[model samples]
Target: MKILIVEDEQEMLNNMRQSLEQELYIVEAASNFKSATEKIGVYDYDCILLDIGLPDGDGLELLKYLKKQGKDDGVIIVSAKDSLDDRLKGLDLGADDYLPKPFHMAELNARIKAVLRRRNFDGNTLVEIGNVLIDTESRIIKIADEKIILNRKEYSILMYLIANKTRLVTKTALAEHVWGDHIDQTDSFDFIYSQIKNLRKKMDKATITVEAVYGVGYKLEVE
Candidate 1:
């Protein structure tokens, strides 16, 4: 999973990064509202840990902006404010959860997992499609009770497809989701074709079927 940590305190930011990195999440950091807004505009994150007391602006404004832009990214407020009003305001602004300062790292991890589950997996810990099973917590994919080895990008692609199962995902969408906004610099989508080919081969070996949509895109047609 990819996450953005927006906090001004250097010590707290480093602590959050270390804890989340140990859990195998790709993490990026922003110290202020401008940097956070820039990152949000360009990169797609599975979850964002936002600090309300930003240097330039209130994090609530950012949340509202994201909502206005129709971004469904999961957000959690990690701030020094622990009052009822603050919590209520953040929740009302579409924050999945609110965590005050001096929180346990384990608790933050749990909140992130829960938020992701609610956002992507229909509140389920495991996602099953035919013979393939995805354990979101472990970030592992299994077929017929045997684990399948997948590279980082491949796993991300498969997870995205599974999340939007039965829907045609265009090459442009896939590239943006997997490679973020940086894909605009690429001249061709040949790498995407290669990734899809390898994913299909792996799925075929495991008796899982993922369908191609010819010139349009791909779909997960399990069973």
Candidate 2:
């Protein structure tokens, strides 16, 4: 999963980033509203952990920006301000959940899972497409009764593809999701091709198929 942490407190922000990274999520951060808005404009995140109290501006404005752009990235307000009015306002602005400051990492992790589930998997832990099954919590892949083993990158690619199963996923988006933002330093998307080749081999053993769209991108083709 990919996440954006919008916080100004350096210590709290680092803690959240480290904890989420430990859970195998790709995390990025912004200390103030300007950087946060810039990130929101450029990249797509699976979930956003927003601190409503920014040194420069209110974090609720970020939610409003997301709405105006029609981006449905799941958002959780993580702020020291736990007032009823603030909570209500954040939710009304389309935040999926709220976490007051001074929280445990475990609880934060759980809330993120819940929000992602509600937004992406119809509020279910297991995501099912035809006969393929993915356990979001366990990170397990099952084709009916059979289980398939995949390496980290392979697993990430598969999860991303499944997340956008109905749409065409461009090479740029796929690279950014699975390999992080450093992809801009690389010269080619040849690495993606290799991963896709291997992923297709594994998928062929199962029921699901990933179809390449030639020069454009790839899409999930179910049988």
Candidate 3:
């Protein structure tokens, strides 16, 4: 999953970023409101860890920006202020959850998972398409009730494609979600093609196909 950490506390930001990255999430950060706004304007994230306090602007305004853009990216307000009013306001402003300061990283991870499940999978950990089944929490994939092992990038690509099964997913979107900031350094989509090729071979026995749209992108076609 891709996440944005909007925090001003350098230490806290580093800690959260490191922890989330260790959990195999693509993480990006902005120490101030301006940078955060720039990122929010450009890309979509699976979840955003937003701090209500910023050096220059209120993080609540960022929530407003997201709503105005009609973006439904899941948000969790991570703030030092723990008042009931603040929590209610954040939720009212479209935040999926709230985490107070000085909380455990494990708890934060759990909250993120919960929000993702609620938002994307209708509160279910399993994602099923045709005969293929994915257990998001356990990171397992089963076809016809038989387990299949996939490399990390391959798994990420499959999950992303399944999430947008009804639409054409561009190479840029896939790279951004799977490789994160590292996509910027890539010179071509060759790496994406390689991963997709491997994933298609692994899923050959399944009732789904990843169809390439010539020079454009790919779409998941289910039988």
Candidate 4:
């Protein structure tokens, strides 16, 4: 999954980013409101950890901006403001959840997982498509009732494809989601090709297929 963390505190932001990275999530960060607004305008994320107390602007306005644009990106307000009023305001403004500051990363992870589940998989941890079954929480995949193993990148690629199963996923989007900010350093999508090749081999026995669109992207189709 892809996430954007908006916080002005450098230490907290770094901590959150590192913790989420260890969980295999594609994470991006913005230390101030301007950067956050730019990213919010350009990309879509599975969830956003928004800190209402930004250095440049009120984080609540970012939430308002998202609502104005009719963006459905899941938002969880993470702030030091623990007042009931702050919580109500954020929820009323369209945040999916409110996490008070001084919270555990485990709790934050849990909240993000909950929002993603409700928004993407209809609150189901198990995603079944064709003959492939994925337990997202456990990060396990079973094809034809047989468990299969995949490397980290391969697993991430497969999940991204499955998430966009009904649409064509552009290479840029795929790379951004899997590699996060580090994708900017790569010159081409050769790594993606390699990963796709390996992932396809692992899923060769499954009813689902990953079909590449020449000069474009890829699509997940069922046989």
lDDT of each: 0.82, 0.84, 0.86, 0.87
lDDT of 2 by residue, 61-104 (tens): 99999989999999999889779999999999999998887765
TM-score for each predicted model, relative to the true structure:
0.56, 0.57, 0.57, 0.57
Model 2 worst lDDT window (10 residues):
102-111
**How would you encode candidate 1's per-residue C-alpha lDDT over 108-133 as one tens digit per residue?**
76578677778877746787778888
lDDT of 4 by residue, 9-97 (tens): 99999999987887689999999999999999999999999999997899999999998989999999998989899899999999999
Give the per-residue lDDT digits (tens) of candidate 3, residues 57-150.
9999999999999999999999998889989999999999988886655457657866777887774789889999999889999999999999
Give the Å shift of residue 218 in candidate 2: 42
Worst 10 residues of 1 by lDDT: 102-111
The number of residue pairs in model 4 that clash at the backbone is: 0
Q: Candidate 1 — which residues are off by over 4 angstroms? A: 123-223
The deviation in Å at residue 211 for candidate 4 is 41
Q: Judging by TM-score, tell me the better candidate of 1 and 4.
A: 4
Count of residue pairs whose backbone atoms collide, per candidate: 0, 0, 0, 0
